[model samples]
Target: MSPLHLLQFFLCSVCIHMFSIFTYLVYYYDLFTSSHEAQEKYDFIIVGSGTAGSLIADRLLKETNYTFIVLEAGGKGHPFHDIPAFGPLLHRSVFDWHYETVPQENACFAMENSKCKQTQGKILGGSSKLNNMIHVRGNVSHYVDWFHGKYTKEYIEEHFNYIESNIYPLRNIQYDSQLSDAVLDAAKQLGFNELNHQNSLGFQKSLLTQNQGKRWTTSDNFDTSKYVLTNALVEKLIIKNNKCLGVQINYPKKVKLFAEKAVIISAGTFNSPKLLQLSGIGPAELLKSLNISVVKELPVGKNLQDHVGTGLDLVLFDTSQSVGMFDMMNFFNLYKYFVNGVGPLTTPGCEVVGFVSTKNETIPNIQFMVLPVGITADRGSHLRKSLGIADFVWDNYFSKLFEKYTTTFFPLILHPKSIGEVKIKSQDPNLPPLIDPKYLSHPEDLKTLVDGIKMLTKLLETDAMKTIGAHLNKNHFPGCEEYDLFSDLYLECYVKHLTLSSYHPIGTCSMGTDASQSVVDLTFAVFGIDNLYVVDGSVLPTLPSGNINAAIAMMANIFIENTINQFNLKTNQHMCSRNISFEELFLNVCPVR
Candidate 1:
């Protein structure tokens, strides 16, 4: 056997043993398999072992009497998964669902070629497995709106706190590269206020999920066996009389399994909606187009939302350490990072994050990512320049390698006015979802990113920025680069092609008691379905101004609690009288079977 295959096998074996019995809470439910059908039907069968599913099983497994099965769509972390510097290693690999967007009209005719691929991870880590790794909690208003705006729940505030306790936050994140400081000073000069946290405008720094240089994804935190499923694809929901008894999991090598208890759909926004539709749930009109049976008619694939960032590259002097682009020493530094958990390779070129409001007073809607170096291009798919623009955006401003170049990505986050959708192309699970993010379809969204770019440029003029030799791209704007570079039209065009999804997709299976727009209730159950729930970003009522992986972990806890309470429906009288705090509810219960 090839050495690479042998190494892969060894890694898989080690990972399995490390995670299995100690943390994994999987329960098999195939009618064709073990007659050990004698085991309790289980309390729940969690599907799509990604962000939400991982957290859900971690909490549920605390109870010994109840059984939980977490079915993953793919296996655990990749070789580079644990390495912070190798963040791009997981992109478009076996883990990503390289979905494409339907041509958007509002965007420049130029965007169709420059921006097409919409990426989301398909592995145990989910998108958290293959993202830029910049972490933010967003503004406080993002959550306030969710509690007061839609779900309108009284206990949501407390639930939010519970979410914070479930995981360890990656802190003490800093960069040894001067490029990191240059990006921040540039933004500050442009008039944008730097925040300590990624989302809050009051100076919350961009807090990452990295712990001492290693990625802090579930595998690094939770019991890997409990959440990370290897090679488990959920074909469809096994519904009996409108209730989800289990899932139809295609394990390939093993016979199919039938989960007895309830089925929770955490297969991300796209897959969860498609699975629901495949099992006869979603918009009747769209499902009809697919010629599939409609079980419960609702907007399963509607109201998609994502934060889009527009890339504006500036060619600078090569002195800037723009990642592995220069110094061979940088690669050696990365080697130190993965092996010894220190040095340049561990930092994802993003050190200082900002949370600032634009000229508008309505709300802070843009999230700017400060990169230490210039980005090459979208790493997902190959460039299709023949369709439109340049083969590669040349560094018009830079003359040599020693000239450090700084790239600023202005992310127009969660524009309330803009919305997108997901659709299934066929019955096949292998087909990527028809993800049309309908970005900038809303004029206001364009304005947000435009103002953000304007703010970014404005910050560069500040006194602190002069030390870094920062300059606006007078020639970078598509139509109006020369017109002050921050003119309305220049900002508009930049916002259009420059703004792309942060890979944080949610709101499709929004959570609420209201059925008109919501796909799941507060307990995460499908409104009309008897025993099913969605526990991923698909269920988020609104996008928090920050990173979502943290929230996904919290929501899993809330959903598990709700499911347990519902399962023991008769105990409301006794349990309610005892008034056990939500925090202590699971302490008395044994580990889940």
Candidate 2:
């Protein structure tokens, strides 16, 4: 409050504001300057520039002689995308696809029209550009089952390490908060142990896909100037004689770019399935209804899964105990962040994370994210609109806590029993798909989420929480006022009304040994299609124990490695079959070590 301090604050505010404007200008400049005609053909054609797509392009360019082109539907990324705290601000912005699910019968009860906003990144880095950048490498068993024993724990670990070394190593949040410390203490008080790096259960500071104070994306690992084509919206796959040979792009101008070797679809969970269905490679009945010719009869948009969770707001008696949005974005924090590369701005919303199990302690069913700021942190400015929360619910419930100092926790169901699917609304590639996660359709999924809520309520009663004077916000939710507040029925009603997607969508195009049930095989090749592959989250058969970005990167790494090995194997077989001396073979073609 002193004169010197006030003067410094004003100067810092001006500098930071100008810096933000500079980032925006830079982004637009890249968008305008980066558009040119792509090459006529490539060794491989990638349909997206998201987590999997970006990694695949970077790896292929660096590890092989093959040339590839990445077709992205979005524009270049902004520098704000590198700041962890600014993630939520990008949700409904131009950087996001802003897809929404259809009205649900059993869940998302309180949102507007009973629809949940599914925010997918439309920027160059894809969802990684807008996501919180939480780096969770989930349990190894998931890979074993999803790949049908083709990838073991050791193999998964090796590829995970490769991704870390190549892209960005995981780092803990540089900023510390009283709320994070209290959550950790409460977990210990409740008999939960600290989690090891490899364990999927228990409490620990979240490892993020960040280094220093900046976020890292798969796209950052490569040179976008040469490989990526921004604003290149792929309309459909160019298939001939049941083989995918190229893609038809509708952006910039209508053009066809062929693939010499293969066509890989890495356009995340929703768009990958949408692209396939548009190109005549999905369910027969759906294709027929739309009057589109069916290229393959296999299922393309079946078996959708996401980590569904609900927010729990806790108001603290002492304002200093919680870091409000103002406190985090103040001049002091901004100054520290810019000068020292460390501060509250480094927070990815969730500071400390915990995993708990209602059935067994070892296998956690719930993943708890400890957010230092409350849902009302922005006073319903951006969060409300970004989440597409109905105005009535916001006015009745969240608006009441606008001035309160609070912390919000998100308890996500690590694995849900409910299953849904993504289908094309029509044959049009420009339209967003019909995504119905069908959350809580299975009775067990609802019961399990309610159990997770109860566990969090217990954490509020812990002595550590008492020191911070933490208590659940008692304001009655708009549609859930019939049941007694804090009661089981009331919590269940609250959950149904306030359900949220953790942004971890997967399993729309699953892989398996059985062609009848899966879309891709062990080699990630399309079930019946030649030289076509799906190497993204869509191919994951089930949900992992935590955030799935790490798993997606691992899949891309393993796929490229497998492709290289296969090529080498074919070359070896062809050469060895001939009656040639080992010396001659080594001297001419295959070199000896």
Candidate 3:
């Protein structure tokens, strides 16, 4: 090679190697890590704008005396977030993280329904903006388990109750839709009970995450006066003096801000754990491979237990009766929903939720969600395979498939003992996390689905489904049809072909009294860190009993409340000595008409 060409090649190699080394060090260990050049001040700064972060920000706003900063990696959610029918439409849009999991062996080498890529929200509402709004509260036993999980912690039950006050309100509607009623009818025909349990307390009826048929998000719950900002993007957490001061966030404008107070990481299950490892907080061994220095060896991205789900898809031959996105009637109804808050547009896909036991038990090990429409065509996944999906919009593959004639019900493996982890694909935060959901990695997880599938097949056999001519998509792999029953070979192949994430990833940065299984205390504080806290799905010690959106919001709200309370008490006590007037608050209030 010529000398000049050689020099160019060497420099490029050096750049790649340097970046690789920097990422590895950050991933494995971190103690010297903090915000870069952050000296600005505020009361609280939260990272991520998803379900949990938004709730935390909004609830903290109840304390108007405090100055808060919200750092979102994705942009703001749209009015579409209020429309439940548009849930699938939101996937691969700007609001979604659009992540794909690392390829699995049991599942197809290529993307199948079970192993299809999934999405998380990047907008203000987080995943709640993108998720189906089925409101099934977990069984009460789960919370009792949550409370009992950290019995040694200080006042855990108090945290749970405080979280409740911020989540479920008394005033919601009970309108019966064609979707939910059908499932309840089917379940009852088979002698399964359907009750009301959307409050994170019980699970008998399909609860609504809607406020009067409009979607309920963190923005709806809080921001009583302020307009929730649009298109905010966060780049990095700003740390200083061995404490999390705030974040160094860059917007589309490219202007960087240094938030004061504490930078709370609530980036949800996928992003939160990934961000922590990116910011240099993960396993020592993995971090060493990436060349990132160990700032805190507190296990930033281990113990990843994701709630995996699978489904039986039935397609009606007659497009005449089959509901799809292209149906002009749907468009008008959707528009009407935005205006009057009535019509099919108000319901997100999977409007019905059920908790069931594969083995006979009062407690549920699986969660079933029913949708009226078929899945949609994902331009993102199409482009990713035939073309290419941009990293930002490529995560959710299954939802992006085919236009809806879906009439599908998905069930989550609720109590799986398996776990997974998040690693850096590269040092670039712009690139997605190297996600390893390790879905259905455990043997019992497959059995849970086997039971769930048998249950769903029965539901489809009902007059509601069969009258509609429900038929399975039996042509995925080579031998999928032969094992339609519960043979080990069939179960493995079927699971590989049909297994997919419910998109509710939890426990990456788990919370527990046992350091062996957890990454934090019950207080949501990262273990071994003085000021760092995790306020998203990543901190849950185990998978929650029901839909993760509301539960995540509850966890985030409680974590923020505790932190702000402590911060406020400290400031209030400090103010008392200085004799500063509360009049500053009155002056700061936005003038009302």
Candidate 4:
């Protein structure tokens, strides 16, 4: 053979080999795939591959013989979503739904036109991918009150324990910041006891939902091998005779999926209610207004509740050394994280958390979060802009405090007397929902927050805080400039102007025994509907004291157990007598009483 011919042959061989290797890599990661086409029918159709939906799919696939599919509105999460510190950056990315509240009369004064930002994760892991990774189950008393004797404390604890397998507490690090130490000492000086573990009262280091230095989202807990259709937006439910059969999805091309056994709506709080209303399962008046034929006249979008909180930024006199947002973005720090899984890149930002009771000693009404580094206007602009904060808030409140060594204290109101609602503006499922949190609507809600702020102020005055030279930023707020700085009235005005949502929206499709009061029954089945259930944050009858991720997981576990037990009973009875129907058995097994 000629030398030229031999060179060409060798080059062609190398190109073919490289192409084959690239193809293998693409298939290995399950990347570059089109929407998964559904079978003619599945045993279960779960909408939204979120915190609850993903876990539900895992349980059903692993513990039963049922065939199921998860329909997700967004694609697989971004690469940074698995990192602990990139949580804030995930907001407004393709991963977030980026829903905003309607203009409010009572709160969100600092945001754009009194509208608070309502962020929900649109990716496979849902909001768990975007949350701060604080793994808190909230106080047990709050759960007892919400359940109202329906669920015993023992039952709740059991479910929590089962879900705890996925969680790993934040481990102690060798490098300690002066800011963190000062905050802990201040908590002690204020007569707060250190909590030994999560779900307990008093102040302590936060227990994160992370393994090592990486985030452990719901996506990590579940089996990803199960079939899931990403970027497939579910438009409406296919319902007939008060029974949910399947879902209609819009994946740039319309497709309908049928479920033979049941349909579960685990589309988080905002989208779940919206989907129900679109399917003519909401309030009769709302459906009629939208020209939708009402299938069930139930309040599907009422009783929306969320945790609201206000924060205070404190400037430290010493600027010799401190961590800031830029520090995490440093190439060296990123290298450290990628190589050794340590450094600022592993931090969840909010290091310490405290639970305090403002009204009753038995139940915690407020949760305190301490961040070692202060958030300045530049950082706020980067983060809050994506969160939908207005230019007015950035200029008036945040911009003045740029480039300062500081620490921030967030006093979160656990339970608010005020309630909100979610409503659909148009019949189009593509448009966002009208979210109205109506934060601080009740007079007492604001009063309770003020009391909590006072407690924070006292903590700042402690000797430990003084040692770190911590002092409140006295920047003049636009609406509260008339009040004297550091006074009670001034602080009250500050809180009213600067309050923000803790991002824990719940109870929109609340669960209760009565059909009139809630959208779902205690068993998580939608009221007045058959073969339909909701097992997401929307069905939480009340807001927990802390982050609601753990609670959502626990509810999914309980639902799985209840479903399996019911299925087993029906199967056993059918073996004994062929005369018994599944519907009759379900009704007999599950009664409101």
Candidate 5:
């Protein structure tokens, strides 16, 4: 080859290398720069820019002329957060809140100091950015039971339809694993209906909150024109004479922001109540104990609920046939994912889901997720460490099973009977809330979980599962050696030691028509405070029978629609009255002091 030809090839190579470097820089810049500085005031001030806050801002900006500001406590999420398989990997990183429950008497027996680890997202998208992207609307019966007398079925249907239209498209993607197939076949043999989407019931491949193999967080879908203050922590609501004016934010410095129309707290279940209590709106006695003046007497953090379940590890004899975390982390797999956006990286690791009823025929009390790979017992592994599993707990029950290809059956109790509470440990706003989920405190919850374990064990005995050579490890847990393996007593002991949170906490600040039973009224306003509202999972009256993200998004959409309708009504009324001044119209609508 001539020197001229070789020089040409070298020039092309240099151009390709420069282009790759430029692409990476652009991606990093976009990923890290998703925050805007806080303004002095706006029409609406939304706290906690998680799932609901993002959607609310998008709808308000698009549908109305109102200007809004969203305050997020964490910075922009990492680019890896968009990878579906990295769902669990984001925890304990800067993205996760890393909140843990106070010591529990009835549950989390295997955890360090009897405290279960609670993970919440602190990034721009909130918990949605870090959550397993399983999109489920829950059973219709749950909605009917919770809102039957309160809301008409037509009203509920309208909200659900709106969510289906706007949010991530829900669809079941096929996996190549034989383990997923076996689980589905076992469900069919057990007489469960095959449902592949949100509107139906029974066992099916789960739908994910992904768009074309990428995790679609609320931040990704939010309108960019709206203002958002990242790394800004809301300390308290600015209330005067039973009316909310704005919020006091701490973005490494003190800043007071005013909202002309209303202040909405879209903080998740735990933080929402904590913020309310800090602002002197909660149970009067609790507020008094904290030495804060009582602004409103209501149950701010009374009914904390979450999905609790026992995870059973089943080892597969064929390790070569299954994919694990190690296999997915290699350079070849990374190249495949970067080039094609398809591989193990495209899945949330929860491929199949089954909803079942142990007692009530219409309502599904138990929900199961089938994970294809075995969870690690050491903190060295990214998946296990990110899950915040106690080191001792893993060593005692799961260390031995780490040698083979493993599949875990997560049997979650959908509607847990055990009710817990979130309370303020101190008056300081910077401190985390005292989260006591009190899992399995109710006797029925324990019995229901034990029944679920037995049901799964039965499923494992089926011919489909047998074809995959699935078998329970049967290794004795630390505190369960007294009873025989697979016995009810043994399983109950195992469950108490191994039950973990499904990360779907809700109902801290419940919404209802009656003020005595709820913190927020039917219109989502604080019972005694004016110009204040809450639009998040905290407003959920009861835990839905599936993943709470979709339901929370639906609730936010409905709330935004209501706000828009109210705004339009006021605007039309003002237009009809030519003599009405702008100030007078504002007072008539907001009435803020």
Candidate 6:
């Protein structure tokens, strides 16, 4: 290396270290400065100030006169959370819930101890804080199926519009590199057209949950900071006579908080069900086994689904065609990012995304997400550890590709057939739930993934890819050497060994009209349990065709409007002679006394 290049590296190192110190200072500052005073009661008590919880609370505070409190298990946000490129680094950090699945029967073969590491944000924004920020509205048909056609396309689109306008508008990245262009061209070569946000198929630059090169999380929509109590974990619901009351929070000291109207659980997929189970609202047998009095017998943690994908890295012969650490950390890129808020650092790694169908061309089954930087680009540093890649696999397979110009393509199974469940182990709210995603357990799911791999291989054979000199990294995966390289058996083995979650887990606390098959009703209220609702990804009855975040926001928005209208209707129905709110009306004029 030249002296000037060495000097540039040193300067970049200093800037990163200084920024790290600043972020730490900011974290500590918020930790000490924030207030955590709990009121005796509220009109509504929201547990888990994640994506849905934050949006619901904010909307309630802004649109209605209802009194509510948001309880978040995690602490305040950091500066690092704002940077798009710094997303992967946030995994397994203080912000993440840091969950790991139990050793699986049919999948996660090559992960540490055969356990797949699940990353969920424990921070205010929840998983949105740790995701790639890909903003896919998903296919309209999926929404139709979710609401069972009761909600029209226009109604759903209106809600989506409301959310997009109020929370975070969808936007594409400012710049596209040569690799991005190549990916797009290759998709065109395969006869794929450009797809808009509403459409499900074709190639397009991914819409992101960002503004001006910064990540826009659900927490950013919250203006009612005083009502939000961070670091306050909801141990269980304070239920009485099968009617929901409030919550019992544990922030080192047990504090009982009453909710006059309802208690909403928006604690993502895993925690929402886990919280329900802990409060004796899950399967009767599980509650009986745990010796807890059952509040309601419902399948609180079944029907778990996620968009699982396996990555294939392509090593480029020409180094300039792909991005590496040096390209991202240089003085020029830093200047462009910090001062102008535009550069590679603005990307969450995925630059181009395409949707393709393995079985049906019209309905896409596989989503192709391309990242400019390779997983091994960081040289066994953060990315490998974040994914929980085994040390042996890294040393043997990925270590050779360090600093090599590469692009990683992930072909995600858009609609997985395999269903899993989340269950409570010992009725402990602090202990992580037993998450069994059961990825690829269904024969169809494995077949779909294999077909996705085949599609990706086909994309590589396009003339566009050849121009960039992109070739599949042929190094045999440690455990998949028994089969011939590039063969179907070898690819399947590679997929099983190197399965990576798209981090979009949903449907644990599913919603439907039938109580036998669902936890929450169409209104998001828990079946057989009044005044208790779930409004997170947990309530999704099935996985959406694309990224799940946009659909979640739309669902929560509908819930908020419906709930507000319901609350208002109740207030009007119970009107008394004295002019007062619903809570006061209930307390003062009971039985016309």
TM-scores for candidates 1 onward, in order: 0.80, 0.93, 0.77, 0.89, 0.89, 0.92
Q: Pick the winner on TM-score between candidates 2 and 4.
A: 2
TM-score, prediction 2? 0.93
Q: At residue 126, give the lDDT of candidate 6.
A: 81
Model 3 clashing-pair count: 54
Q: Which stretches of candidate 6 lie over 4 Å from their true place?
A: 1-29, 312-317, 576-593
Q: Clashing residue pairs in candidate 2, if any?
A: 110-497
Give the alpha carbon lDDT tens digit for every residue of 238-312 in model 4. Answer: 998888889999866788889977899999899999999999988898889999999998888899999888874
Clashing pairs in 6: none
Each candidate: RMSD: 8.4, 4.0, 11.7, 9.6, 8.0, 4.3
lDDT, candidate 2, 451-550, per-residue tens: 9888888898999999887888889888888999978898889889989898899998898988788899988999888989998989999998888898
Who is ahead in lDDT, 2 or 4? 2
Candidate 1's residue-wise lDDT over 9-39, tens digit each?
4554454344333222222222123222212
TM-score of model 3 relative to the true fold?
0.77
Alpha carbon lDDT at 143, candidate 3: 49
lDDT tens string, model 6, 279-355? 98989998999998898999989999999988746444456653566667778987898888888888877888889
| Candidate 4 ranges with C-alpha deviation above 4 Å | 1-32, 166-176, 196-200, 312-317, 377-381, 578-593
In terms of lDDT, the best-performing candidate is: 2
Residue pairs that clash (backbone atoms under 3 angstroms), model 4: none
lDDT of each: 0.61, 0.83, 0.60, 0.77, 0.78, 0.82
